[model samples]
Target: MRVVAIVLLGVHLAYAGTHSLKYFYTGVSRGIDFPEFTAVGLVDEGQFMYFDSNTMKAVPKTEWIRQNEGEDYWDREKQKLIGSHQAFKYNIQIAMERFNQSKGVHTVQMMYGCEWDDQTGETNGFRQYGYDGEDFLSLDLREMRWISPVPQGIITVLKWSYNRAELEGRKHYLNTVCIEWLKKYVEYGKSSLKKTVSPQVSLLQKDPSSPVTCHATGFYPSGVTIIWMKNGQEHHEDVDLGELLPNEDGTFQKSSTIRVTPEEWKKNKFSCVVEHQDKTVTEKEIRKNNASDDSSSQRSIFWQWIWHLKLDITVG
Candidate 1:
């Protein structure tokens, strides 16, 4: 009940060298209306598998995974998630007792992942736990030890630290098994993962007194740059850059706003430039808001604009 949604943003690498595989497991206490336990698996920031107590099954979220993995694979994943779900239920109770909390919503979460840099042949692994939106414990892979940020987690750290076999098994999985699986998934979805789509850049202005916003959406790979130029030179003052956000279809959207008075804008040539992958969009290529646009299309764009603005405020 009252599930804690964890949004993990992948590091946008300038080069296509780094790739990651991550898993998030969330367990909530009883007396809530939602599922007690839910798990998600992501490869390169794209969700590929999901499981929940209500479904009692692990399902593939991507066509590539469904095509590449057989029923046996889903069965194994389902069994593992079921076991984890039971453990999370018990752990949530224990955590409540430790915190002297009862009869209220509480959450136990685990996030573990591995990252590989193919070009440099570098690899890293991490495993961390959280309770009630705060860090509870984490594993130091290099030192092969558990660490707790809160006093309530000390007991768990002590108990898990003594399990040498489990620690070793976890280390093996993170360093070896996890990396192997990540590589396989990358190969399976290489076509979709590696493809790129150019963005549709637009210049939006609500009114003469409002800031001019450069909006770019429907870009692939989630990496793009937006900038404002004044009189053929890059202008940074009074500019706000928005965070990259995912569209409903898995592409990305970003915005950059420049504050310039109407007089200054009219006196000088101001431009918005967007760069993505190998393409560069200049002001000459941007679509401007116009009255000729259909009302329905304009309404859709207005809502999207408002949505992004709200998201930017929330994320800030």
Candidate 2:
């Protein structure tokens, strides 16, 4: 939606947060990224801001505020605000507070009045208290600087929807939040990499010297493909890319195996190429003779076993 920009004209007197004053100017300014919707400005009400590295300098918060809201300018002297080189999370909190104070918009209250979606809630897409497409989100303020794409990969906006109650209840919203794309992004790289099948298949074995079967697996949102090879050349016949199995953390895993008895296993180079995006990863395990019948399935499924991970935080 195209947002009609509203120029803020600070509620106070002539010396407001909307323009750069002539007599004052703060050293550093804190503002939001218009493109990404992330705020990154200092907020010293008095315009007297300092930093361990840059010392305290005179800068007006009004002008900084005016930078985005209106045509207000900052004065070089007099007006002052303290240093605002604080953490972004804390800064965002300040932004939210200021927004609520200025506009009489209380997010917590909005959230309270809106329907609950804690069961499968995700801090994704745009808006803080609302859902985007599928209309799971109550609001779709894609026009705001701080509510759209957001910034720094952190959801700075407190999501809320103006018409969240209209998205219907759990039955439909759940499916809305249960986005199909979430199951499409897999955590690849080395941490999630499984090294069960390594190197080339030195040998092959099958009970009746026929075709062999194998499975492919990965974290959720992953795509799997079956790739059969003979003497390092890709073999395309009789391979099936089965329905992907889901991971606990929302990834998809899949496997496909063809029954290859002893004779076929010995002559064929077998592998299941895991596919995600434009990358293709290969894992190999070959048998020299068609008589080796100990299923490789056991080792393949080892990573499926889970252990817990925990972390503790303290707030003083």
Candidate 3:
């Protein structure tokens, strides 16, 4: 999958007890075929709503959200995003000017979100901006101030920080309004968001000299841990963990590879242990690539595993 640099705050909390509501906004310079501006909303790491410059309307991506929300809700969201679209376009131009860039592809992105721990009743929120894949500015909620990482963003920080009332309002929305909506969305889609599905674990090896790959697929909630064990002891060396990727069915998949020579492999017991929710999958044997397996079929299946990771947005 071709992953973008847009960071998602609190998305890793897509676990059993923690829930997150996040938004991502992107603005691009001219010459790109992609949308000039786009927005997306996610709940528990599943996309629920989306809007783009071409569409100019906020549309629900999930059936539950579409069924529960009325026309007025959609209309209100559309109007708000339309305004944001214009603002982002202007912001992108301003950013380009600040960086003294005349042309080429440039992107400005914003990510903000709230996380709630149901078991502990704890809540947290964050807002950050990026320019050309680098951090530009962010909100310091505790101090109620804006912080800029790049020199180009210092002007924006100084100007935005002076607005005390707006800062207070932003803080209130993130801490209060965002949490309320997240709870409502969770209730609306509890059947999907709260459900847990165990993964189908497999141990694959292309050749005798290749590293052993432990693959887990079709897992829900995406909070999974994969580790290598040697002689029943936790092993950390020569392990490479892959990113969690979404499946076509809305579930997730991940892989962890361990490098060990054939001689060492036979000398000790090596195992791959995967833990998701309450289920555990332990595999001690390797499944070698079948001689009859077609490479083209494998390539097709690999492309089928790739999917776009959508961005998200929420009205404060």
Candidate 4:
């Protein structure tokens, strides 16, 4: 993820909470063939109902898409979307070839999101695209600068897309086509969406000499914080924070690790505190007694164990 300022129509914008608009194309592409695209839209971190050419349905259907008569219907717009999807489906291969690797699953994601003041609707933020899960290009919209390097041809096309005339045209389309879709998405879908699903937390010490790792999985709306705690206080030293990644089920997972000496591990109880969007907190503890080390054996062996913790928040 990259952070940048947002500027539109020669006006400067202030930074605020992240608001994102993303179009993602993901599929496997082998050899010279165009990759099959599974395109979807995301706002903030939640899925918004969008046309999937493969499914021909508003995919990953939320309650709003499922209920609300004719609200999720977008058959007439599918043809227009397909053209954009195909451009990326073919262009992802071009990007791979340019990098000299063209075999495997390819993903192209275009994102327009920024931290902008809601009252003023101003932002100093970024417009970016990634290829195969890696950053390929980025534009600092506020500074009118290309934040990442791109080939000459690609940059030329990007410049044209950002040109004033094209931008005005896009703004019109967005007001009519995008904003309306977003209004429906937020009004009907967003509030009802799950903010946090209790994480499946695990403690693993695979090797006797390696660090103890606490892994969390099956969470939603990925702004999760995983921290190691010594006793009841936060422990930050020697701790490594891992990247939050998506799961096959469209949920999220992450992990954190901390190095502990054998004596320290035996003497102190270590805990992992997970904080999520819902204000529901969970703590998973790894104690010397709970750790799967066979006391009968001369050699110490630590086994992996999983603990599920849940906390419910009640709003008064």
The C-alpha lDDT values of all candidates are: 0.73, 0.29, 0.75, 0.51
In model 4, what lDDT does residue 63 have? Answer: 52
Model 1: how far residue 47 lies from native, Å? 0.9
Give the clash count for model 3: 7
Q: Write the per-residue lDDT of candidate 3 for residues 39-131, one digit (tens) a residue.
A: 778787666788889979888877778789999999999998899888887887787788898889877777888999988999999888777
- List residue ranges in candidate 2 displaced over 4 A: 1-211, 286-316
- Summing lDDT over every window of 10 consecutive residues in candidate 4, give the lowest-scoring window: 306-315
RMSD to the native, candidate 3?
5.5
RMSD (Å) of each candidate, 1 decimal = 7.1, 21.7, 5.5, 11.6
Task: Write candidate 2's Cα lDDT for 111-161 as tens digits.
Answer: 101111224443223222211111111233233222323332123334322
lDDT of 1 by residue, 105-212 (tens): 877777888988878979898887877766778889898888887788788788888889988999999999999988888778776655678998878876787888
What TM-score quantifies how close candidate 2 is to the native fold? 0.26
| Cand. 1 Cα-lDDT | 0.73
- Clashes within 3 Å, all models in order: 0, 72, 7, 6
- Residue 101 displacement in candidate 3 (angstroms): 2.9
lDDT of 3: 0.75
TM-score to native of every candidate shown: 0.70, 0.26, 0.77, 0.62
Candidate 2's displacement at residue 188, Å, is 23
**Which regions in candidate 3 have their CA more than 4 angstroms from the true location?**
1-16, 203-213, 230-232, 238-240, 257-270, 284-316
